[model samples]
Target chain A: MSTQMLTYLFVGLSFALYVGIAIWSRASSTKDFYVAGGGVHPLVNGMATAADWMSAASFISMAGIISFIGRDGSVYLLGWTGGYVLLALLLAPYLRKFGRFTVPDFIGERYYSQTARIVAVICLIFVSFTYVAGQMRGVGIVFSRFLEVEVSTGVIIGMAVVFMYSVLGGMKGITYTQVAQYCVLIFAYMVPAIFISIMITDNPIPQLGFGSEVNDGSGLSVLQKLDGVLLDLGFSAYTEGSKSTIDVFAITAALMFGTAGLPHVLVRFFTVPKVSDARLSAGYALAFIAILYTTAPAVASFARLNLVDTVHNTAYADAPEWFGNWESTGLIAWQDKNNDGIMQYGAGAALSPIKPSFDGNTGVHGERLLSNQPTESTNEVYIDRDIMVLANPEIAGLPGWVIALVAAGGVAAALSTAAGLLLVISSAISHDLLKKTLLPKITEKQELLYARMAAAVAVCIAGLFGIYPPAFVAQVVAFAFGLAAASLFPALLLGIFSKRANKEGAIAGMLVGLVFTFTYIAYFKFVAPELNNTEHWLWGISPEGIGTIGMLLNFAIAISVSRVTAKPPQSVEELVDNIRIPSGAKAATEH
Target chain B: MNSDEHTKQASDVSQIDNQKNYWKANLKLLAKLLVVWFTVSFGCGIILADWLDQFSVFGFKLGFWFAQQGAIYVFVALIFVYARQMKLLDRQFGVGDENDADQESQS
Candidate 1:
């Protein structure tokens, strides 16, 4: 088939599969809509959770990130996966036993205050929306590449698909569709890794590929060869670590705790049948996720070496058309800086597009090259991390269909996550803010209708914001994690575990946490940039690491406030005990 | 209120004690899990990553590996430990279901 036709074929089939699942799971009642009738098999729930958790950031950008940063990127590797451990051990089971539809529900019930729940709803919305903005952008980027559509047009198309499934079926539809998406994306992720691993190191398994001998026939292992190549290019060795130790520490910790705190992933545990299953399913999710996590570093190593070898120390004046094609999207670019028309790429490029300045020699004069100029590069190597996963098939000269499958996989990842977060956002709006707190008399069916409306409206707003994402995939995602880590996590942890955690204490902690984390991130990411003040940065921590400090403040404030305030109600303490032990709990009935 | 029900209630008190004991067991398991979590992540991975770097394994920095792949593998392993404890809890409490899903769904 023609590439265009084949691309549409794969994307269409995948979309059909998702919508088909959504149709099959139309959710007859509020219970079905919110938590998928709480009957999802542990394994299926695990698969859905994997898809829900991976998001576009994981499937598309993570390895790409690792490949570029070398040893410094280990922070991401540890932080992202380590958080799941926290989720499994600390949060998932108890929440399942709590029999709540949303995280805020638990907060409200535990604190015995509608006000506390509303505060949580606000925090949840801010965090989830910020996170979804990145995924929405991922959808646009992928669609533009595969479907040959404008990025804005792609965003609209993606919004429509998310609206159709997520709005109509809610969590019920999203769960099954996510299961299918998990299969497609993991397959798309692993296939190229396997092929390249075998090609480069004669190891069929990517995990072994990293430690095996490189094809260079130099009797050196892949790591040794990589270190040698990086040194030759004035870059750090592949295996040698260079990130500021403290920063790596803070970032990893923040992300780990953040994962445990994210509402969307935590809520997935509530969909399983029983508390024990919730605990077991969390393990299943991690085990499924670890497969990709384990393989990713090896894939990244292989790709980096292959990329360097392909573009550098070669006679090829031109890479294939895909490089230029993606470059026009402003994701990848090259400049000729030394009045040399040829492109040069490597360490000397000094990271980032040369501010379009490196090539004063190009269309504009006297502009210092901001990005790599292959013309100036002695060994060409201008690469972008976002391209790493997508370009895998092309890098290995795979067929067009495989490349098309990758594009579909990226969309699947973005859409699944967007749907999940949107559901949480919509639920917070209609369930917590509207029916529960604002209007106590709303009918169940009417509330469900409002949820559907919220999903559609949120999609449009999210789509608009997604079309103009303010940060890169990883950075924007960090903001979401930061907000969750600092705010809701503390309230939930304290409310159940500490009998003295009254509504006033919980509310105060959440407000302080939310304000401090958001203000810190906003001040740094947006406000500080506007002020142009490099001297004002405290501790050299970006908006990303600020969450750990914010989380501490939340915990401290909650504990201190509880020390001075009235204890939580006797009934509330009893409820916590009930949540702690399943104790013949009946099926949850959403009202 | 019946004589037989009252006798049953006396036995139920012992069951309540067993539940309390089970809760203690849960707490111990949590403590162990948290310690392992802290050691793998904060100890070898972060707080002492450099200190542990004084030791190396197969040219891999012991601390850095712990911070990265080692910690993650241990994390994956940690989930199973928690699951195993959950099963034991079920056996002691007579609540664990064996039809639960196995954790290996990786493609």
Candidate 2:
């Protein structure tokens, strides 16, 4: 069968499975909609959480990012995984004991202020929308590539499928579907890794394969060979860091705290049966997540080495079909600047396209052969970072079925995360905003209707973003992490850990953190990008690392504010203590 | 009235004692686990990464391995350890399922 036929077969089968599961576990009430009726087993919830947490970024873009950036990419590897530690230890159990449906519900009741709840709802919406937009874009990219549809049409199809499951099943539907997604995605991710590892190093386990000697009989380890290849191409050593030490530390810290604070991931713990199960579920999620995280670097190393070997010094006329195929998608481009058919790619040429500058040779010269044309560089062959993972199987000459599986896996990862995020957005609007505050007298059935409607509306908006995303959307996604870390994490942690932290303090801390992180990112990323370098940075911290500093500011402000503010009411104090001791908890019910 | 006051005083003292001991144990456990978490992730992964890179374990630079894989493994282990420890603590403090509302309250 043709590759297109296989892709349709695999993608169609997965979609059928998801719809079937949604029908099997359709949610019946608000409780079911919010927390899967609080009946999910720990291991099952763990799998679902893994699927929900690992987005297209993890499945599709991570290895590609790592292959290019080298050791500096460890920020993503360490920062993303280490947050599970904080989640398991600091947040999951206590939140589960509180037995709430949404994150804003916790903040609303814990802080005893509707104003605080509204603030949280705003933060949750901003974070979830930014995140869901990226997921929708992933869905579009996979569909357009595999199913031969326009990117917008692909997004619409993806949004429709997600709408069917999420609106019908809510958290109940999303959970079981996510379990299935986790299986498909992990299988797809590992199969190519194993095959490539064997192809290069004669080892099946990618983790060990990454460290094993190359089959070329040079006695050099795979990483050593890869480093040599990269260095020859005028790139830094593949295993060495290019980022400054403090930036690495700050970005890692931001991601760690941000993952712990994301509302979508936090809400998953509420689906389990007990407080103890919440902690166990987090561990299980980490274990499941670790399987992919550990293998990604290996795959990255293999992909990088394979890619360099295949492309470098090869004649454009003799280049493989995958090159032309990707080139047609506009993901890979070539210029042949020096008029040589042989492509030269290196740090010197820089993958970014050169803008035609109009000044003289001393400044930004346009189309002028400057005196400093080092090494007769043609500067051809620019490849998009996003295409590396999707193109990996084809680059290695893997079978057609494996390529199809990758398409299915990318769809599954994006759909699952998008579903999880949309549910959070819907629940915040319907359950927290409408039922809890705006329309308290609304019945549970009405609230459920509102939740489904809200999800539909959110899907429409997310789909639109996917279709016509602002150029800044990708850059602003990281700010979502910073916002979560700076605003929500401090409030949630302080609410549980400190009995003296009053509503006044929590509110003040959240605003201060939010405003500080936002202004820093906005100024650096948008207003004055030229000034984003270390000379202009505060303490040499990039906007990406500014969240950690903001979090500290939150803690300091919260403590000081609470000292001067009135104490929390007696009942709120009791509530904090009750959340700590998880003995008398009950399943979440409609208000 | 006199008997009621005596009983109230006794229960209050014990309640305070339980709260104190429970919090103390919880704090100590969190401190120990956090130390391990921090040491592995930020310490070995970042601060000591250059130093540890000189040593290779199974062809991986030790620091690179920790940053990528080892820290995650330790994180998973730490959480399970914490869960097990917290469960025992809950049992010791008589705050496990013994005080839970009947199973019917659960879904």
Each model's TM-score for chain A is 0.93, 0.95
- In terms of lDDT, the poorest run of 10 residues in model 2 chain A is A357-366
> Which CAPRI tier for candidate 2?
medium
lDDT of 1 by residue, B31-59 (tens): 99989988888787777877887776643
In terms of lDDT, the best-performing candidate is: 2
DockQ of each: 0.31, 0.58
Error of 2 at A406 (Å): 0.3
| Per-residue accuracy of model 1 over A491-544 as CA lDDT, tens digit each | 877865677888888889889988997887777666766642334544655567
Clashes of each: 15, 0
lDDT at position A47, candidate 2: 100
Q: What tens-digit string does per-residue lDDT give for candidate 2 at B1-107? A: 47857886879878667866887898899999999999999999999999999999989899988887788889889999999999899888866744344654443
Which candidate comes out best when scored by TM-score? 2
Candidate 1 wrongly placed segments (more than 4 Å): A313-316, A339-342, A348-382, A470-474, A530-540, A587-591, B1-16, B51-61, B94-107
